[model samples]
Target: MPRKAAQVSEADKHAAEGGAVAVDRALFLLRAFRLGDTALTLAELAQRSGLYKSTLLRLLASLEHARLVVRHADGRYGLGPEVARLHAVYAASFSLETAVMPVLRQLVQDTRESAAFHVEQGEHRLCLYRVDSPQPVRDHARAGDLLPRNRGAGGRVLRAFAGARGQLYDTIRREGVATLVGDRVPDIAGVSAPVFGPGGELRGALTLTCPASRYRPDFRTDVLRAARALTETLGGSFPFDD
Candidate 1:
């Protein structure tokens, strides 16, 4: 008896599907670091990436040897310096800053509050650009500040709209907008929204921070509107489900 051509083709198709699944699992391991944690234990990584412990250990060993992941003295793992170098290479090749600078400045001017642009930096979020309010008593945020993704309004905004699922991400996503009543600084309030790029990928967040006393009932609406306007200007798309 001879096998049919369809049977051979189906076998080949199954092999290809299996390969793809493996690749997806590997990528999921890398993505586990993006949840704003500085480091994760093996068990935590397994739970987050949905990989079996045995599989994750093998993958982590390979990644660690390749300098993509590093194991800390405490037996936790985090992205290695090599990953930062790679990000620097990619950032140098692209110009997200050039594209969004004018919009950020406009947002600050229109809102009369401090505005900043933040992007995910390994296990944290980094403020890449910021504009201070003209008010003498205004809050100030500086560029190059690394913030925990769960901390403030800007961080929550990025986590929420980016479809992240940790406690911080879940709470913000459920709320639609992030509001901070002094999470970052005493007496300072902030609001933020996620900025998406092509293919609905999270690019960063556009945020406004001010004194808590200045926030009114309409502040959230204003921030949302500004974020939407910026999204349109940049030809960015977001998930309709969010």
Candidate 2:
């Protein structure tokens, strides 16, 4: 006989059925947009969301009516300004700075370089917390800015450590850290390492930044130390090569 499906509790079944199925499916479609994908064609959205075109039409109609999604002049669909407004509200209300800013501050004190924590936001990375170096000459980046993921050390570190595989990511997986020089800007350099959760999942990246010419041998080492410390504090372990 075929195996029977596991039984669900009465409470669980009630909770699962409490919400409208249409709402869940619509939300799934919205989540298909990742960092770097500012706009998507209808066909692309259908493929990424695993929904049929006819079904997408119905869903997109509802979403568009609510200003949750917009169709541009070029016929591509993108998130509407409503999404930005919601994100702004979320950013204003939710922050981990109280918990992690002190750690970033210490990293700055140790390396005398700007220290930051980054989190993946779709195809981009967001600087969630940052502490600038006291030196008059320092690199510039603001918290909450969405930065290109392929350009900076923190972005690459987030990708490599979070399971995107490649030659560079393979090396980062083994070493637990990443370094970059003039990758994003001609005069800025960075060292980055992964911070993980207690379950060994990626939490974010801890990065140190300084002028390309001023980056010293110890800068990378200090970033590694700070990353490890932060990971441990969050109940996670920094993986190292065997």
Candidate 3:
């Protein structure tokens, strides 16, 4: 007997034909630049993006004209000034961190523990904002770091509010918080609670982390209070309070 044909959804069919090929290829070329590779030769771009040299050159011309990519004096191409301008504008307009940083710093002062705001990114979570503990020895996770989203208190809290079905998540959802000790990092304790947006959707997680030695049973009260304040500030209602 012959093997059955694979199924193709109508959405996939529409996506395959509706998008612009040139625009997609140009974006592929731009995304080929990673965190550390500041500049790339034409050959390097071709190799990394798996595009032919001729096709890449054609795409690069348009990109360079739009200032989306630029060539240096050394004949290597990198992201252009437009990207930096776009980033600056985005940072200025998106003031979530600015508004939340004061709250995070206040939490750190109150609890003397590192505080952070985390947002899920696929299978990982990104630290969007962080305030370190005042202690001489403290945990050292920084903004933009990608960490596993299935471990740590912050991850569990986000996962729970995102509707992942499990006993652990169920308990977290019910309690309005999650706690982890020696889970994501060795000898570290963390407590996290959900932050929500105006329409009550999960926005991010507010987490407090410190050495396991500093883990106090009453710390949950502070964490929960901070989460509630942040939720209200963002025009979201605190489910636990309701």
For residues 19-54, write the lDDT of model 1, one tens digit per residue: 675555655677666535899999888667655567
Can you write out model 3's per-residue Cα lDDT over 139-226, one digit (the tens) per residue?
8999889988999999999889889999999999999998889889999999999998756889899999999999998778888989
Compute the lDDT of residue 155 as modeled in candidate 3.
Answer: 95
Could you tell which candidate, 1 or 3, scores higher by lDDT? 3
In order of listing, the candidates' clash counts read 0, 5, 0
Give residue 60's lDDT in candidate 3 (0 to 100). Answer: 92
Off by more than 4 A, model 3 = 1-94
Worst ten-residue run, lDDT, model 2?
8-17
Q: Model 1 lDDT vs. the true structure?
A: 0.73
Ranking by lDDT: 3, 2, 1
TM match of model 3 to true structure: 0.61
TM-score of 2: 0.59
Model 2, 1-242: lDDT tens digits are 64442563222233335687667668878877876787999889876766666768888899999999999999899998888899788667754666578889998888788999999999999998999999989988988889888778899998897678789889877787788888888889988888887568898988898998898978777888888878777756777621
Model 1, TM vs. native: 0.55
Q: Each model's RMSD to truth, in Å?
A: 13.1, 13.1, 15.8
